[model samples]
Structure formats: C-alpha cells, structure tokens
Target chain A: MDLRPLKVSEVNNYIKRLLLSDMVLSNISVEGEISNFKHHYSGHMYFNLKDEKGKIKAVMFKGDNEKINFKLDEGMKIVATGYISVYEREGEYQLYVKDIRSSGIGELYRAFEELKNKLEQEGLFSQDKKKQIPFMPRKIGVVTSSTGAAIRDIITIIKRRFPPCNILIYPTLVQGINAPEEICRGLEYLDSRDDIDLIITGRGGGSIEELFAFNDEKLARTISKLKTPIISAVGHETDFTIADFVADLRAPTPSAAAELAVPDVMYLLKELDNKYDELKSIINKKIKAYKLELENLDTKLNLYSPLNQLKDKKIEIDNFLRDLTYVMEKKLNEKKAEILELKGKLELLNPNIAIDKGYGIIIDNRGKLVKSIDSVKLGDEIGIILRDGKVLSRVENIDEGEKIDEFNL
Target chain B: MNLTYEEAILELEKILDELESDDCTLKESIEKFKRGVILYNHCKDLISKAEGEIKILLEDEENTKEETFSMEV
Candidate 1:
C-alpha cells in the first residue's frame, strides 16, 4: 500500500491531467435538458444538463456559441459535443462544449422542408408567379415590428436611398404564435389600399424558430394571392423562409429589402440629367447640321444674285450720259460763232448804207434803169434819184461809144 | 406640361429627328424648335414635380386620414 499525504491543489491537478489524457473523456458527446442556464455578460454560457439518471455542469465559451444559429433557453434539449475536464481551483469536473445543436431543431427543420416541398409542388415558388417590382415606387408598405432594429435599418436606408418614397408601416408582431396571422393581416390591409405601390414584410436577424412566423403556410398563401408586389427579408443572409419563396422578391437583410424596394434617387437623378443632356445634344447637333446646310444653300444661290452686274451697268450708263452732254455743248458753241460772222458780212452788203454814202440811181421812161447802152436803144424818158431827191429826163442816142470810164457809185 | 415623362421624351426625340433630316424647310425648323423648347421644359418639370412628401395612414371603421410622419425606428 502506497500512502502519500498531498495538497488539494496537487490532487486536483493530477485528476485534471489524467482526465484530459484519456481518449474517451477527451472527446465525447452528451445529451440532456438544460437547467439553471446563465449566459454571462462576458459571453460565456454556464448551465446544468440533467436527465433522470444523472446530472452534469456544462459550459460553452463565447467563440463556440457564436457559431450557433439559435438561442439557448432553460428547458431546451441540446446535444453537446466536447471534452470533460477538472478545474483545479474549484475541484469540480465539467463539460466544456465545443459544439452544440438543439435536439428538437431537426423536427423544426423537417417541417420547414415539408412545407417548402409542398409549396414548390403547388407552384407557389415558381418564377412565373412572381410580380415585377416597380422602377420607382411612390409608396412602400412595410409589415414589421414598429420598435426594433429591423424597422430602423429599413427606414434609414430607404430614406437615404430615395427620399421621395413614402413609407406606410403596419406595426405587426414579427414572431410568436400570433405573429404570422398579424403579418397576414398587415399584408392584407396594405394590399387593400389603393395608394400602396409595393409591400416589404420582414424583421431583423434572428434564430430559425423566431423566424418561423415567416414560414407559416397561411402567410405564404396570403402573399401569393396579393396583387401588389411583396418582398420578404427575414433573419440573416443564410436564412430562407417560405415567405421568401412565395413573395415576388427575397432579400437577405432588412436593409437589403429597402435597397430592392426603391431605386436610388441619386442614380435616377443622374439618369434624368442624362436624358436632358441627350435631348440637348441631339437638338444642338441637328441645329448645327441645319446651319451648315444653310451655308451651302447660300453659296449655291450666290451664282444667281445680280447685285454686281447691276452695279457695273449703272456706272456704264452714267459715263454715256456725261459724254453726250459734252459733245452737244461743243456743237452749240461752233454754231454761235458762225452766226456772228455771217451777221458782220450781211451788215457790209446793205444797199441803204451806199445810199447814205452819196450814191445815186437812174431809171428809163418805162421805169427801168438804163445802165447799159444796149438796154436804152430808143429810151424816151429816164429818172434819176439821189439819196434825198429824184429827177425825171428823156434821152436820145445817135452814136454808141465803146470807151467807158470807170465810175464809182 | 400634362404629358408623362415617356411621352415628353418621345416627342422630343421626334423633334430631333425632324431637325436632323434635310427635308425640313427654314419655316418648319423655326416651328419645330419652338415646340422642342416646350417639350424639354415639360420633361425637366416632371422630375421636379414628383411629390416627395412622406405620410402615414391612420384608419378607423368609418374613415382614414393621413399625417406626416418620421421616425428613427
């Protein structure tokens, strides 16, 4: 017999090392109903799992519990997988859970599957049955809890994305036994309204059981019958509910639902600006082309404009009129000089001037001037006239003399 | 001004096509340009005229009334 008096710490340390080294205790699984469950503020879970035969203390750290998709309740039946170990300070052995799953969740999932298949077979999940979401919904009808993160996220995002979109919230319970019916009523109420353009029904992230309200069969049928388009956003990204399949569209998160419900006003504003720019550019381009055409027509018509030829003809006529006026004036001056010279010669040939210079004239008896001897062969009477007096005489001629003296009269 | 954005845009497109074609005379161009100005103004006005107010519906058995509403949640 070997007997050694050892300290409590030493003994507890030895037991801890021994249990950790054992293969069966190092890796094992335990199934039990949870009691006295305490999820600590530090994110560590402490609980007691018990059955009719035995009981054990259990703990799950924050990191491992975060991987779980559901919450741990007091009466929940769970299957925990991890190693058994002794704590040296407390001198107690406990189960440190690395992985855990609800034992009854399998049944819930089974029901989910059965409903999904039934709906799929009924054509509720068909692509052809879904309604089209409007490009710019004037009003969005929301079916969700009025005081929660889901509604807050949806409102913030929708307002940020599209300010012009009006939201009509139907404040309904998102979970529990009556939540599905309330959701149905909310959806129905919004659908009945004429002003509602689109409907968004959902809640924030939650466990699978909490999201089961969206999986109700009656809710799916109500959604499928609605004329207005619907979008379902339940739980987190991985969660897919029956409402998601039946609705016109499915979003992974509440914020995502807001994004899908309406178009971004900034982007639409840009598109509107683009359309305006397109109109301006198209019309401006057309106007420029027309301007170029006008220029071409102007050049073609330049050949027909008689402005230059008319100007040249006007100058030629002015020159002809000036030359005609000059020639006529020269001819008039020559005529005046010739008339003056003829007047001087006419004045020198006047017989009245000779009479005034003392020249006399004679006439024969028959009132003829007998200036030549042959003309006075038997002249009986003759008349002689002076400048101031006249005398009458008779003449007889017996011999004709050829000798004649020059006389100036 | 009473036309929708789509109709207004369609007519504006027609005006552009007419101006682009060589068949239009000077008189026709002047007329179409005037009409184009009107259509452009209509399209611009439609975007600005989108009633952007937010409202909530309060319903009773007999009547329903609308009130302006805003909330963080």
Candidate 2:
C-alpha cells in the first residue's frame, strides 16, 4: 500500500522486476510472422512479431543474431525464444530475443540460406566476375516455362519496347523435379552458341516448393559459369533465390528482365536522329564557312587588281594633259599680242608706214638713214622713200633756228 | 569514310575542327568537306540498318535456321 508518488523510470523498473521474477515470463517462446524487421547499424535487430490477433515488439542483439543460420525476412514464420522486459526510457515492455528458429515451411528457406552462403563464399556473386549487359544486344536467349505468365510477360514487354531485337525462347520446365536440369540445359545451350548475346532465366510468383528449382545449387553454379551476361527474375520481387544472387543481373520480375535485357528502339532512334542532325549541320556549316571565305578572297583579289590603279593613273594623265594644253595656249596668246604690238612699233619706225600717213624719210648718198642733222650737210644729196615711190633730193639750205613746228615747216 | 561508325564519327569531328581553324586553306577545306560528306553517309547507313525479326530456338541442337518468333508466347 505504498501510494506515494514515483518517477516514471522507477515505475518502469518496478514492472521490469515483477516480470523478471515470474518464472514463465523470464523464459518464454513466441511464434508469429515477422514484420517491420530492421537490423540496425549498431548490430541490434528490431522487429515486430505479429499474428492475426496480436503483436509484440522484439529485439535481438547482433551477438545472438549472428548465430542465426538462416536469413531473416519479413513475413517469415519464426519461433523466437526470449524474455520479456520493460525498457525504462520508453516505459514499454518488449521481448529481448536470445535466439530464433524457423518453423512450418522453413525447410526450404534453410536450404536457400545454406546455398547462398556457400556460393557467396566461393566468389560466385563477386562484382568483378559480373559481365556487362550489352546496350544493344543482337539476340537474347530466354529460359522459362512456356505455359507460365512469366514468358508471356517477358515477350510482351520486349516486343513493346523494341521490335527489332531478336529473342530466342528456350521453353523449359520452370518448376517440378526436372525443371533445374532443363533450365541448366537451356542456359548451357545458349552459352555454347555464339549468336546468343544475353540470357534471361526466370519464372512467375509461386510457393517455396514451386520456386525451389531456381534455388538449386547446380543451377546457381551453372548460371555463374555462363560467359553471356544473365538476368534472374524468379518469383515475386520479395523472393530472393540463389540464382538471383549468382546471375550477373537480378530483375525484380520477368517483365523487368525484358526491360533490362534490351534497349528501347524509340530511345535509340531519338539518339541516332540527334547525331544525324549534328553531322548534317556541321557539314553545312563547313560549306557556309568556305563560301564566306571564298567571297572574302574574291574581294581581296579584286581590290589587288592593277586595272583599278591603271584607271586612276589614266585620270591623272588626263589632268596633266589639260594643264599642258592650257599653258601652251596662254603662251601662244601672249606671243601673238606681243607680236602685234611690235608690228605697230615697227610700222611707226618704218618710213613706208609714215609715208602712208603723208610723212617722208631722208637718207644720204651712202644709203644710210640720217637720224641727226649733223649727218646732213648743206648742198648734200639725200634720198626720200615714200609708200608709193622713192625720190632723190638735196639739202638745199640749212637753217640753224630751232623753232620749226610742223605747220611752220 | 570506309571506317567503322565510331571511326567515321571521330573523323568527322576532326574535319569539323580543321574547318574551324584559321590557317586551313580553301583547297584543304574543300577536300575535308568531301570527306565529311562520305563519313556522314556512312554513319547514316549504319544507324538505319537494324537486325532482322526475333526468333525462337527449335531445340537444344545448334543450327542456323530458326523459326521466326511472334509476340504470342
């Protein structure tokens, strides 16, 4: 009857003690389908064990889960042995699992785990050993049951995506006892041939026993040995078969396998069109560049031509010729005027021109023109020349007086 | 121009580079143009040509003749 207030952690601790003291609660077993499984990075596994009626939280430390031989998967039927305890921080009770065992249809899961671990150890699933899937596979070889929905789906998808790609369907038993051998044979046959570019082996969703063929040790080994890249698509996306790990690629389903194996023709066509356009455009650009260059060269050649310079020189000569003609004409006009003036002066000196105006000239007997009176003497003979005739005369009387005007004479 | 698709593309790129350079003469550009045309035609031919129809193997035996498969599985 201690009704005093207690902290949340103290209450949680009290419940934890009560649960641990109970003999049955400390050592308990739980069987349910696993849900929300998470193997934390810190090496602790957290999950929920749920049945149709109820569910419980469970955690298994990495140390204990490491001893677990089988792979834990969601929705797996497992019997977990653990003790119930209260986590003080959350104030919630949870199962601290010590170990887990498979139950019901777990035999097949155990076999799958065993083979996966063995093949993984043998390096069959190594990334370096994986072959690259061709981007454009020439021909694809498919091994699946002809009657199953898997083949139908693969064919439909491959055809829808790429029509030109070649597919060689190797219809074989995808299940039953003979399925493993037949699948191996189909794979081998495809591998031995040179025409086969890639291989896809798979089946539709089924039970563990029905899908057991894909988990066969021999089939996984054979898939690993294939030179051609293979894609495994057995069962649903949740089912991970041994062949899925061994194959070069693992598609979630059969339809996905076809999608991975062949490239879409539409996408390839688009890319090819782009490249083709680039080539044409580049060539056209080259042509345009050449044309521009030709025009430039042509212009340069024309500018360099001597005909243009010759024309310029011709105009220059024409100007010089015009100047020379003007100079000659000016000189001739000046000479003509000077000659006219000189003719006037010469006429003034000419006695004939004076006689033409009723003047006379005198010369001595020696035929010299007497310009001064000293050249003449009294009673000396002289000559007078007129425009019409010439006459002899005498200097009859010499007058010393200086006032002889024309009217007086 | 008689080379593979990849080689033809590479050659075409080289020709483009040559055309872009300043020192390439007119005569050299014409020659490169002709070569580029040939390479373009070769690439187009390679791209257009595709494989034949899909087929299914008849049996486990090896043979060239195969039945042309259809969409029906």
Candidate 3:
C-alpha cells in the first residue's frame, strides 16, 4: 500500500464522500427537545437535540427539511431521523435531521395561540376601527400570493360583475416564515395610494398550520389600522384567522370579496334610469299645479279690486243725483215766474189807477151806480162824486145824458 | 303672491323631515306635496326675477360711473 500526504481541502472532501455513502449512520433516528435552532442562508438548519441527560448537535440540510412532517420550535419534543455527519474544519460530529415529527401538541402552537390572545385582548380586532366598504368602489386593491388561484378567482368574478372599475393587485407571500411581514408591507403600500378605495386580503383554502402567517399579531394590527377598507378572504369559510376578525369586512371566498367591493354596473344604470323617470313626473306635476294656482289667484285679485267697485257705485249715484237736482230747479223757476206774472196782472187791473185817471162815479142812496137818465128822473134822490169832492144832486134825465156825452167828446 | 324663498326652504325642510319619519298619512303627503310644488315654483320665479333685476342694475351701473360693494367682499 502506498501512503501519501494530502492537502487540507482533499481530506475534507474525502470525509464528505464517506459520509454521503454511509447509509446505516445517515438513516439513524433520535428523539429529543429542540434547543438553540438556527436556519442558515445555505438552505440548512442547525440546532441541538437534548434529552434529560444531555444534548447533541444536529444539522438538517434543505432536502431533509423538506421531508419534515411538522414545524420545529424551541422546547418542542420532536422525533428526528437523519444521518450522522462531521464538519472537518471544526472536527465535530452533528446529527443531520432527515425526518421530524411532534411528540405532542408542541410549543409552536402554544406560542401562536399566546401571541394571538395578547393581540385579541388589546382590542386589535374591534369593529369600531374597521372602515366601511364603499357602496361602489371606483378602485379595488387586492393583496395575495402572486401565483395563487385566489387572485384568478377574484379577477374573474369582478370582471363578470362590473367591467368599468379598476382592479390593482399587489403581489405578496401568503405562506411561510416571511409571509406575515410581506403582507403587512403590501397593505402599507396600498394604503398610501389615494386611488385605492378598498382592499381584499386572502388566499385559497389551506390547513391551519399552512395558514399560520395570517394569525400573526403584527399583521392583524396592521390590517385593523389600515385607512382603506379591507375585506379578509383568508382560507375557506370554515377556516377563520386573525386577519378575518381585524379586517373591515369578511367574505367566505375571494370571489365573494370582489362582489362585496363593487356594485353591478348594469344594476346601477337601471337605478339611475328609474330615478330620472320619477324626477320627470314629479317636476311635471309641480308645474301643472303651479300654473293652476296662478290662474286662481288672478281671479281672486280681479274680484277684490277697489277701483272697479268704486267705479260701479260712483256712476249709478252720480246720474241719480243729477236728475233730481234738474227737476227741483225747474219747478222752483216756474213757481217764481208765475208769481211775477200774477203781480203784473194785478198792477194792470188796479181800481186805484182808474180813480187817478179822473173818472167820476155816481152812487144812489145805498152807494149803487146809475147809468140811465130815466132812473134818476123817476124820483129821485141821487149822489154824485167827482175827482176832488163828493156832491149830492137831483136833475132831469134828458139834461144828465147830454152833460155825460159832452164831457166824453 | 306666496312665501319668499327662505320661508319656502324652511317649510320644505319640515316636510322632508315628516316624510322621512314615515308618520304622515297619504292625504297629508299629497297636500304637502302640492304646497311644496307651489313654494318651489315661487322660489324659482323669485330667483329668475332677481337675476333679471340684477342684470338691469348691472346695466345701469355700467352706463353710469358709480361703484358698489358686494356683500361677499
């Protein structure tokens, strides 16, 4: 046999080959509680497995971790099966975990529930902080796994219901260790944008363990504080998560969330049309009533006009008084003229005027007039009066008639 | 010949409150609606008349050299 010195790298490579080929040691199993676990960027997990007596250093490569059945956590008792391996640089042996399972309910679930309860008691899930979703959102924001089927279902449902509304999707991790932080960041991004009216956060159905990120307390509080209304559509309807309680609204599925965020365009159009018809009828009736009332007021106004009433009464009384005054004046003038005529006639036929004209009068013994000479000659006694004085005389009838004719000539 | 714009607006508010309360009878609603229509028309007419008067006032001001201050100012 030929013995030769080897380089440091060569010896380490040789030991790595030997470890890969050793089936018996690589497949061995150990059961213990986890301590001081760390996952490296090289896709390997490093930790210690401890029993009541002592602890052993362990390593689980990326491939072996894929085969693990349950999540590994500090203080969790797990049964791990893997190969025995040695790090050449450190000159230390470590158990590489190929398989892992929970010995009981495990510490991971307890830790998850503890954090969730703390957040719940803090009122992070209170409905008062939840915003109301717009009746008809003009823009909708979706936060979900970029490659998941949930996004596809939401898009399809929204398109079918309404075509005009804008839909914006923010890619996010829905599972794994970093999912919670990524989801919170995505929400902050959408909330900063003024155009987004509502947000839908969810994923397709999954087991409770797979959906653990949604139950994160930080993520739940971030959702509750979002200014934009958020609709949680996390697993199936049966699967409730902390996000569901904290979001503004909860939907059974991704499709249901889209429906709640927007109104049906056709339905809205029909409503507008109906309102237009109703408004038209109301205005028409108002106009007709207004016109009729105006006409009624016009009639009343004409009825109560002071000028017309005064004119009617004035004309009737004026004519009546005019005719009365004319009749009274005519009667008064006629009476006065008749009195003047009576006075003139009396003046013209006065007996005193005849006496002033020097006419003589003869009287008998009883003051009677005698005109015939025969009456005086018959016996007697006669009296005569002149203009100046009265005389009593007796004469023959023939002589008296001659003297009266001579005076007349 | 009815109420002014301010008076009509106040009445309209009353009627709207009554209608929203759901306590008014159908007959009462109809009567109120009729009165509301009259008031609304009166308000519209008053507004138009005011606009016309404003136009006339503006024309007169333009023809003259007087300056007037606006209430808003």
Candidate 4:
C-alpha cells in the first residue's frame, strides 16, 4: 500500500477525532482508585485512576473541579465520569473527567462528616460560644430561597406568633455548587445590618446532596462568628448540618425557627395582668396593716389623755372641801355651848342679883369693904347699902364670937 | 405614657416585685401600684394595636425598597 507518512501533530489529531467520534468512549464512567492526585494552582486537578490490572491518567479542569463537593486524596476509590481524549502536546490519551463521586458513600456526606469533625475539634460547636436568642426580637432576618416553602412557613409562623416583629428576608440558594457561597453572603448581609435582632437560616427538606451547602466549613464558621444569634432550620427533623451545630439555636424546621425567634404577645399580656393583680393585693394588705396600727395607737392615746386626768383631779378636790366644811361646823357648835354655860355662871354670881334677894353690901367710910371684925377695927364710921338705899352708922362692936351663926342669905 | 411594650412589661414586673417586698412602705406601694396599672394598660394597648403585616426589604446597588410581602402558595 502506497501511503503518506503522517506528521506527529496529524497523528494526535486523528486519534483525538477518533475517540471523540465514538459515543461509548465520549461519555463513560470509569471506577478505580485515585493515585498521584495533584491539585494545580490553576484550579485544575490531575490524577491517575488505577484498577487492579491497569491505570489511566485523568485531568479535571477548573470548571468541573469546582463542582466537586469533597477534597480528593490518593487511594480514595471513585467513579469518574467523562470522555477519553488524547493530549496533543504530551502525545498521551487520558480521561477528561467532568464529574467525580465516591463509589459507595456520597462525596457530599463524606465532606459533611470530615468538616463536622474538624470544626467540632476547633470548638465551633461549643455551647459557651453560642449567643443567647433574644426573647423578643423586633426584627428578624430570614436567609433562604424567597420562593420556597421554607420562607413561607417561617413568615406564617412568625406572623401568627408575633405580629409586631418585622421580617427581613435575604433570598439565597440552598443547594447546588454555588449554594455555600451564596448562603455565606446572605448571612454576611444580615450581619451587616444593625436593625436585625435575630437571624433564621435554613431550607426545606431535601436529599443529602441538596442539604450539603449547610455542611460547608466556611459557612459554619461564619455562623459561629455572628454577633446576632442564628437559628438553623435545615431539612426534616432527622437531618442535621454543620450550621445546626454552630448556630445559637437549632429548629427541626423553618417554621419552628420562626416560632423560636419571637415571643407571643398574648401570653405576655396575661402575665402582666397577673402581676397587676398581685401588686394591687399587696398594696391593699399594706394599707390595712397601717390602719390597724393607727387604731391601736388611738386606743393607747385615749388612756393617757390630759382631759380625763383633769376630770379625776376635780372629783378629788370636791371630796376634800366637803370633809373640811363638816369638821369646822361641829367644832363651832361645841364652843358655842361652852360659852353659854359660862355666861349663866356669870349672871348667877352678879352682886346686884344677891342684893335684890335681900342681901346687903357693906363698906367702910374710906370706901373699903370689910369682910371680918378685925379689918373693921371699930372704924369711926361705916356705910351700908341695901338694894336701893344707903345707911350710915357709928362704930359698933363686931361680934367675933362664934363664927356668927351661919347666915342664911 | 409613650413606653414601648417591652419597657412597659419590664416596669410592670419591677412594680410587682416592689409591692411584694416587705421593705416597701404603704405610700410607696400605692404609688407603684398606680404606675403598674398604667404600664399594664399600655402593654395591653400595644398588643391590641399590633396588626400583623409582613414586609419584604429589597436592597440593590443603588437603593433599598420595601414592599408588602405575602406567600404565594
């Protein structure tokens, strides 16, 4: 056969076209263990997929590598999906991997576990680091898909429980490759606003892959660093994510998170009413106690009142005056009777009365009265007076003999 | 009189605590009781006046806009 010698470039181009034309070779899945894995600074990944018998080189460009949910390492068994094509410069055929996945467990799950363990050891899940959820948040920021059921449920629950709170929604993607970055941005946006009191970040129920964005380490760290308390409400009740562990509070669903973010106004009002009744009762009791004390003081004051004491003193003085008047009257009557008896004696001893009864008085000439014969001594003259007449007589012998018969006057 | 719901509730609680304490005088208790009544009424008014309105805040490079938000189910 007469054939022209093909150039090296032509040969590589032919093989490249041949592999690209084959449908089976163009889109295939190859299962092998990853070896000699090298992540280039250009965001491309180069590795070799080795089976028990053979090995093939693979290269994943930055676009495809960006979709990888887990870090690639040597010896990890995976299934790479892409076409086998020849490199023109190297003169080698390799698999241009479009996607890679772990053979048994999902790559996203592995990534979730890996990041969870790493962050747990770093104390991002520590309870003391979590902030306290505000009891009554005036404004709540919700980070999730705006059109999804998660936001709808959160808004409904929040409105029902607390109507006064303002709900601020930060629309974000919760799944796919760009989900982690978008979610981080949403959190940052809410954090930047000073008016937001609390943050509720989450999505509705989904598969592990769909929930993988919450497993991102950077997102978890952002949640841990937030000054405003965050409530993570991801997927169903059974699902848990790294965001759940790092958040200040966790709710099984978005509605539950909304319920936790605000307080029920009706219940608070009832509590205030109870407090009001208690305060009124306490004040009444205090007033009653004071009234009783005043009454007791009044009784004590009446007992020692000066008006009552003056009444007692007046009664005492009246009794003393009566006793003094009675004693003085009795003494005066006794003195009057004694004085009357003395006056009667004086009247009986009167000489005029004796003379009126025929008894005469005798006197000497010199106006001396003689009571015995020796005192007369034969006086030259003597005068005698009877009741109404006087008689003159010469000295006469006075009978000294025989005490002169007791004269009966 | 312009007290917020939170402040009113907090003040009501303080008044209740003072009234319950033995150290409070009768005149002081009465004064606090009057204040507590006013606070309770203010809180009740706040709760009754609240109309549950949902609003969405849309912020772009140039301006921020507020629109009434309702769930489309």
Worst ten in a row by lDDT for model 4 chain A: A400-409
Q: When superposed on Cα atoms, how far off is each prediction in RMSD?
A: 11.6, 14.8, 21.5, 15.8
Candidate 1: what's its TM-score on chain B?
0.85
Give the alpha carbon lDDT tens digit for every residue of A90-148 in model 1: 99999999877678688789989999999999999999999998766778998998777
| Tens digits of per-residue lDDT for model 3, A1-409 | 8889998877877887788689877688888999999888997898999999999999888866743434678998887777887787876677878667566444557866687788778987676777888765666778887567788787777766666556677777787667788789889978998988888999988766566778877898889779999999988878878788889889988878878876665665554444334434554555566679899999899878988789878998999899889999999999999999999999988756766788667777788887766556655778867767888876644454356556763
Model 2, TM vs. native: 0.55
- Please give the ranking of all candidate structures by TM-score, highest first, separated by commas: 4, 1, 2, 3
| Candidate 2 per-residue C-alpha lDDT over A225-340 given as tens digits, one digit per residue, 9 for 90 to 100 | 99999999999989888999999999999999999987676775675566556656655776787789899999998888899789889999999999999999999999999999
Alpha carbon deviation, residue A280, candidate 2 (Å): 2.6
What is the iRMS for every candidate structure?
Answer: 3.5, 3.5, 18.8, 2.3
TM-score of chain A of each: 0.55, 0.54, 0.53, 0.53
Worst 10 residues of 1 chain B by lDDT: B46-55
lDDT (10s digit) by residue, model 4, range B2-73: 877778888887787767777877777778888888888887776666665566667789776767887887
Candidate 2 fraction of reference contacts recovered: 0.39
**Considering lDDT, which of the candidate structures 1 and 4 is the better prediction for this target?**
4
Clashing pairs in 1: A365-A381
What overall lDDT goes with each candidate model? Answer: 0.82, 0.82, 0.72, 0.85
Tens digit of lDDT per residue, candidate 3, span B1-73? 5664457656755755564454665566567666666655664554333110000011244352213212121
Residue runs of model 1 more than 4 Å from their true location after superposition: A1-102, A311-409, B1-68
By DockQ, the candidates rank as 4, 2, 1, 3
